[model samples]
Target chain A: MVSLRTKGSFLKLYSWLPILILYISVLNEFDFNYLNLEYFSFNFPFILIFFFTLKDFKHFDYILVFIAGLFNDTVVGLPLGISSLSYILICTATAYLRNITIRPNPVKDWFYFLFIISLINSLNYTILTLFFSFDLILMSYLVNTFFTFSFYIIFVSLFKYYLKGLND
Target chain B: MASSRDDFIIAIRSAFLKKSTQQKFSLLTLVFFSLFIIILSSLDFKVIRYSKAVINELVYRSSFIVSVPENFIKDSFIQVKDYTNFFNKYKKNISELESLKSNYVSNEITEYENRELKELINDYVSSSNKILAKIIVDHDSPFLKSIIINKGSKDNIKIGTNIYDQSYLVGRVIELNYKTSRVLLLSDLNSNVPVTIAPQNIQAIVTGSGVDSGKIKYIKSGLSGQLIDDSIVYTSGTGAIFKSGVPIGKLKFFEENSTNEYKVEFYSDFSQLKYVFAEIITQTSILPTTQESNENSVEKNNPLDAKLKILEDELNIIEESNKKFQKENENLKSEINNLNYKVLNLNNKISSQNKTIDQFNLDTDELKFLRLNLTYGHKCRKSLFNNKGFIVGSAGYKDCVLRKGKIDG
Candidate 1:
């Protein structure tokens, strides 16, 4: 009976790993920024949010994701709620896609992610520049979106492995 | 087409309002909440500001805690990389250190001179205290280059306080919390510094290139031709945003599309920063306590006025030196007077001693004459046979006494 209880607890922890990782990513800013690569950065939170929310993972709570966004904004020194808005918009887009889809395709989801991130980045750039009077490089945003979109497929495969383990 | 339109509406509504089993709020409510926060944060409300500060305090601490493992890994990686090139780096550093050590003494003397000159030019003496602060978070964000340091208003770290890596200017504090502040690195897109290029002495504004370097902007036309690579760039202290003469970077020229472009490669690597110094500056009026109240009424605002003040100081120095020369001249005059008085006294003493010597010589001659008269006075007697003998005191009588009563022949 004790062994079964331990197994159950371990399973619960495993199931909640995605949200835990989300919080860590937001706080840690898990992008390999120290690599010192020129014009190299990707938003790991965006990729995580898009993939999990599109799959509609049970433990990936929207409220937690929103809070993560706020944390990200704080860490990145952006105006409050900017990252939250972007993350929520991603959730909203994924929800709309989920609602309209009869059959899901990873390629379609990936392209949709590219479009959503591009739009979100554009909106982010506009808001920061026009509203907050923040100086930003459009090229940096373009590169960020490109890198984030490119890294999504690779991370998605790993996330799939996690889901498979949970199901097993 | 009607069915498709209906489907689209239903899907949009579901995306906005629908909540999953484990979800706490619909996506639409969160979106609106996000918008509300953005608007509220922009407004300067005391409550919002204080709350944001509190949130920032919490978030920064949490972020530091969360970053420990990652920082350790990053540091270890860097250490390994450093080890791979340790010997070459050591050799280079040794040569660099030797040169830097040679320059260090002159640099300190110049710093002191600069401080004195600044004090003379301005009405206040600016005393700066540099307090060491650890970098709590340096994510090196591509969009906005900034770092969170473990010092803030509690540590007298106000907005615009200059941060430095060693002596090189890194950035300034832009946002301050209670125990943490955000420093906008010089490499940020929003960062603009007024700088003077050495060797050329050209004034220009350096704006970050949204990368690791800064681009020189707003130079006078035709001055770009005079700029050479590796020229030093330092803060001009214009607009009083940055302190004057703080080393920022060196100028590098790159060609883009057959056109010359210049960028400043910063002295401090923002990526490798672990600790920094935040300079807290306090200014006090330079006037003496006795004259402060009276001088306070006088205006010393413009450069011309400062020049006049400097001239007045120089005049005072010249007056002091002149006074010293007059005192020395008075001393020399008294010394000459004392020497002349001594010379006159010596002359009187010498004359008296000469008179004594003459009297002594006369007494000896008289004694010799008396002895000669006992023997030769009979022969030399004027009344008897010696009419040739004169009086004893006369020159002829003295010579006859010495000749033992002999005649003139």
Candidate 2:
């Protein structure tokens, strides 16, 4: 009986791992920027949210994701709600993608992620520049999008391994 | 085609309106909430500002707590790197210290002179005090470079307060909360500093390139050609956003697409900064309006008083000049005394040399006379048979011997 209870608790923790990781990533800004590579950064939260929300994971609450976005903005020193908007928009896109598809393919999902991120980044650039009068480098956004798109596949594989473990 | 389009619309609406079982708010509701927040944030409402400040305070503290482990890792990495280059860095620092030490005394004097001159020029006396603050969050984000410091309005950290890393201007406080403020680093894309390029004295704007350095902008058409590598860039106090003459960075030139691009390499590395100084400036008017009015009344009542006041100012200036002149005169007097002493010593040396020369001449004459005597002794000697010369020891005999034993004809 004791062994069964312990296993159950472990399973619960494992099931909630995605949401926990989301919170940790937002708070910690877990990008390996300390390596000091030139123009080397990727939005980890974007990848995490896209994958989990598309999977429609039970524990990946949209409200928590929204809160995580707020935390990210605070950490990154951006205007409040900007990150929240971006995140919500991503969730919506993934939901729409989920609804319109009968059969899911990773390759299709990956390409769709690229399009979504590009659109979101362009929107971000426009809002910051036109509304906030911010002097932002368009090239940095482009590079960020490219790197995020590239890193999505790698992170998605790792996340898939975790999900498989949870299911088993 | 019409059915497919209808299906796509239905999918979008379902995505927007539907919420999962665990979710609290629908996607549509969250979207509207986010928009509401964005609009609220953009407005300069006092309540919204306070709310934002509270959120910032909480988030900053949480971030600082969360970042402890990462900071340790970063510090360890930096420490390891530092150890590798320890000896080289020490040697370089020693040489730089030596040069800086020589410049320090002159710099202090110039600073004092500058202070006095500024007091004379401006109507208000601005006193600045730099308070040290710890950087709570320094995430070098690629988009917006900024840091959160543990100082805020409570500590008199107002917006536009200049932050410094060891006296080198780093950035300024843009947002102030209760106990924390956000400093927009000079490397932020939004950061624009009015700087004067040294040696050339060119005025220009430095805009952050979203990198470690800043790019020079808005310079005169031909002035960019005059900028050389390592030319100093400092705040010009043109917009009064930053204090004048605060060193910002050095101008660096790099080739891009067959054209030279000038960038500012900041003196302080933003990434390595842990603590910074926030300068709080308090300005006091030099003369009160009441005093000015009293002076005006006095001048109108008696023009002589106005003349006397002018004379007093003139006297003060003259007194200051006189003190300088006195110092110069004292220096001149000491110099003159030294020169006079040197002249006396030189005269004594000349006289001694003249006496020695006279004695040498006399000795030479005696030696020549003796040689002549050896050759023509009998011809000039005065004796019982030969009485052509005077006595042997006489002056006349000595002269005649020196004259080659010849008698005056």
Candidate 3:
């Protein structure tokens, strides 16, 4: 037995499922890499959406971004938190975008979110990667994010079907 | 059955009330998504792992339901195969027996009796250390990755413990829980074995890069009479990583031109895998020369890192190949629409890759070293262009990948 508030918090955590699935699927293809823009490496937006989608993400989005970045930074196996900072900036911009964009369209909202997230993710990942400056197939990451975001949007849309029923 | 006037009154009351059903539903949906977002951002994989277990339960339950027909079909096919094989053996044995009956003198040789003598060896048992485990769930995903074993820390299974099937090296223990441990298959990306390339004291690394096949790299190719296809690639587990003189894989297709690849087909069949014995030792003394020093060992990365990388790559290919001509031909042609559609699929793939990496705690110095070489090669090219006068700006597109994964001094 849990309070509705606790349950609500718990459910918020559950949203991570879709994102986690997204992260893992991408990771499988790319691998723990920066130089190879394949599926397994964490590109910019992957980190961006990834950080934003975590639990307790509402407050201190920037801190969450850096903390999340540490995992990659630690494992990027070099000067850590470069990806974290980059990811934070992406999330920050997203929050700003969310505030500014006041259209009441969920589909449009998703598209806008995806576009901004993609741009920021790549930019951040690219900037951090310059410190190490290993050549990756930059196009590959771009394509991957583009498709990954689309898939995320589609998967997200599917949930609407069930929720619509539940609401009824 | 209610009238429009009644509906309007109910709706009015609902709107003014403390909470409306629609509002509650909206709040619930918001809460659910918010919860998901929060959970995701935490990066504490343990909870996600728990969630995955619930998902696995659903998947397994559904898979069991759906696989009923598949099993029936498979079982029928196997029955037919068994009957045919039995007939062949029985026919051959009957003929042999009949021949023996006609030819033998005093007492005809029975099928069981006309066999090799059973040599008995004395069983002298002493102190023994071993851990027992069973494969509970096969990795639902592909990639010849890792298998989840029922044994965990409770069973004394620790990371880096060697695992075996009867007499062959299968994999090493990478992750462990209280009652379950995940065995990193010898065929997983992070799995690396330091083996002595028999007959010739050639020491190299045998790493699992894919399913059905593993690569034997780092050996100086064509040193003597080495060709594309050869026989007998036995494991000389030089670095105490595995038992000496065990079979890892067989020499399969060879890249005659490239010094990098010696593709060998993996013999340790994960498909037939069921039970395993985990060796608890943390570090294998095998292959000491090339083994990574502890000081520089990278922590296990989230598999998500790997997946995101792949998506980025796919995008890059489309942009590169489709870029120049597309803008000219455009009415927003969406040249490679498939690329756009794959967004979620790519993300999903990336996420799973992250999960797998996390599951096995994937870490690779070899990969790290390889990445380092790319950086170094760029540095070297910069230095070379600067020193050798190959024209400064033109060297930007030198396009180099470090050969041999060698770490530069």
In candidate 3, residue A150 scores what lDDT? 61
Error of 3 at B295 (Å): 47
The alpha-carbon lDDT assigned to residue B347 of candidate 2 equals 100
> Candidate 2 or 3, higher TM-score?
2
Model 3 shows how many backbone clashes?
Answer: 92
Tens digits of per-residue lDDT, candidate 2, B300-357, equal 6875676567568878998999999999999999999999999999999999999999
DockQ order of candidates, top first? 2, 1, 3
TM-score of candidate 3 against the unseen true structure: 0.40
Tell me the tens digit of each residue's lDDT in model 2 across A1-168: 999999999999999998888877777776556677767788889999999999999999999889888888888888889999999999999999999999999999999999999999999889888998988878888889999999999999999999889888
Which candidate number maximizes lDDT? Answer: 1
Residue B23 miss distance in model 3 (angstroms): 17
Ranking of all predicted structures according to lDDT, beginning with the best and ending with the worst? 1, 2, 3
Worst 10 residues of 2 chain B by lDDT: B302-311
lDDT of 3 by residue, B131-176 (tens): 6677654432222366667676776666776788765778887554
Q: How well does each candidate reproduce the native contacts, as fnat?
A: 0.85, 0.71, 0.00
> Residue-wise lDDT of candidate 1 within B1-409, one digit each (tens)?
9999999999999999988888899999999999999999899999998898999899999999999999999999888988999999999999999999999999999999888778777758989999999999887677999999999999998999999999999999998999999999999989989999998899999988878889998999999999999999999999999999999999998999999888899999888899999999988976556564456346444547656876798889989999999999999999999999999999999999999999999999779878987887655545555567676566766566667877574
Q: What lDDT is reached at residue B339 by model 2?
A: 100
Lowest-sum lDDT 10-residue window in model 1 chain B: B292-301
Clash list (residue pairs), candidate 1: none
Interface RMSD for candidates 1 onward, in order: 1.0, 1.1, 14.0
TM-score of chain A of each: 0.97, 0.95, 0.55
Candidate 1, superposed: residue stretches over 4 Å from native: B287-313, B316-409
